[model samples]
Target: MTTLFFDLDGTVSNNFQGISRCLNFALEQLGLRQLTDLEVLPFVGPPFRESLPRAFPGIDTEAALKLYRERYATSGWLENSLYDGMAHAISTLHSQGFAIALCTSKPRVFAERIIEHFDLAPYFKGVHGPELDGKFDRKTELLAHLVEHYKVAPENALMIGDRDKDVEAALHVGAHSLGVLWGFGSRKELLEAGAKHIVDRPDELVHTIASIA
Candidate 1:
């Protein structure tokens, strides 16, 4: 079975709600306006340092990041939940002998905490995120690290996620990406980002991988 690298946040955890809330909260604290759901989506998949400046352009970058992280780490990220059937989908893939890895831009401490909190640590072989000083921005760079760390062959690796970033990351690693429509990003965005396949449900990913395999 091929190794599957999945994105967290908007992909599996539906954690964009927390991120959206935190971004809005941070903007509010900065005396700015809250973004609409459509407006907030572009911010979901990428790192905060990158997304924040885009969402709240005039705000103090440092303070905005600080507040966003503080709020999100405290409760915003946790406020989110998983997509239905995600656990089952993961279990089925695992039972079928697929190796699962999490490649996300969330902070390491918070990523670990979220996985543990969600009781999902056992399903994955590895989980990775950003380091201190918050330097990771591009999906291509993160994907390269994941590919090396997982020792994944591009042909045997698939990235499953809900955003364009996930697709970009997969492409960067030379892995095929299957975009899930139920989470954060729109179909157009996914396609524009070069996602060739789309799965409407979690279990559909099984077929997606099988077809690729």
Candidate 2:
């Protein structure tokens, strides 16, 4: 493929600790019951707007979002760490001449900060994500915008992510997808979402991308 779109949360870095902690912080602020990290795992890959409402069932998502970001911006963002071999995989691909960028459901500013925190800023061409105001919240919309803005053919791009939404977004825009088992998603979940290729570890990422692309 000429271009590669990588998902942030689960694929590139293991941000579960940060995400779950922030989620609980928001819940505690709302005087709601806090969830364990494992309980919060399902919400990691999806937008917080969707997850908050579903978790609380009739709470103000906007308020929860504000609280989540309040904590995320300060300490939660720094809680993340790169997946084993992810740096190697990304650098290897960049050296091979594939254009790489981040495609995440996170707000652009937050995603940018996380990239910089991980010292991964130089390897990426751009960060594609929604605004804090919730524009382009859907994966399909974001992917479509990235494709048009970058002048990339859908078929010539491969989206690599750890969740089904990533595969769905790629399919919606007619691009290829590779699902990673190292993240939160299970094998059946990715296959059911129509991901054609799957890799079990970060070390296998480069070869898997080469095969799919």
Listed per candidate, the RMSD to the true structure in angstroms reads 1.7, 0.9
lDDT of 1 at 90: 86
Q: Mark the 10 consecutive residues where model 1 has the least summed lDDT.
A: 131-140
Q: State which candidate has the highest TM-score.
A: 2
The window of 10 residues in a row where model 2 has the poorest summed lDDT is: 47-56
Candidate 2: where are CA atoms >4 Å away?
Answer: none
Candidate 1: tens digits of C-alpha lDDT, residues 1-213: 479888887678887678778888888898888889889877777876776666567668778778888898788867878788888888888889999988887877778888888888898898877775765556678778878887878878888888888898888778898898898788998999999889888878777788887
Question: Which numbered prediction scores highest in lDDT against the true structure?
Answer: 2
How far residue 36's Cα lies from its native spot in candidate 1, in Å, is 2.6
Q: Clashing residue pairs, candidate 2?
A: none
Error of 2 at 186 (Å): 0.7
Q: Candidate 1's error at 53, in angstroms?
A: 2.5
Query: Which residue segments of model 1 deviate by more than 4 Å?
Result: none
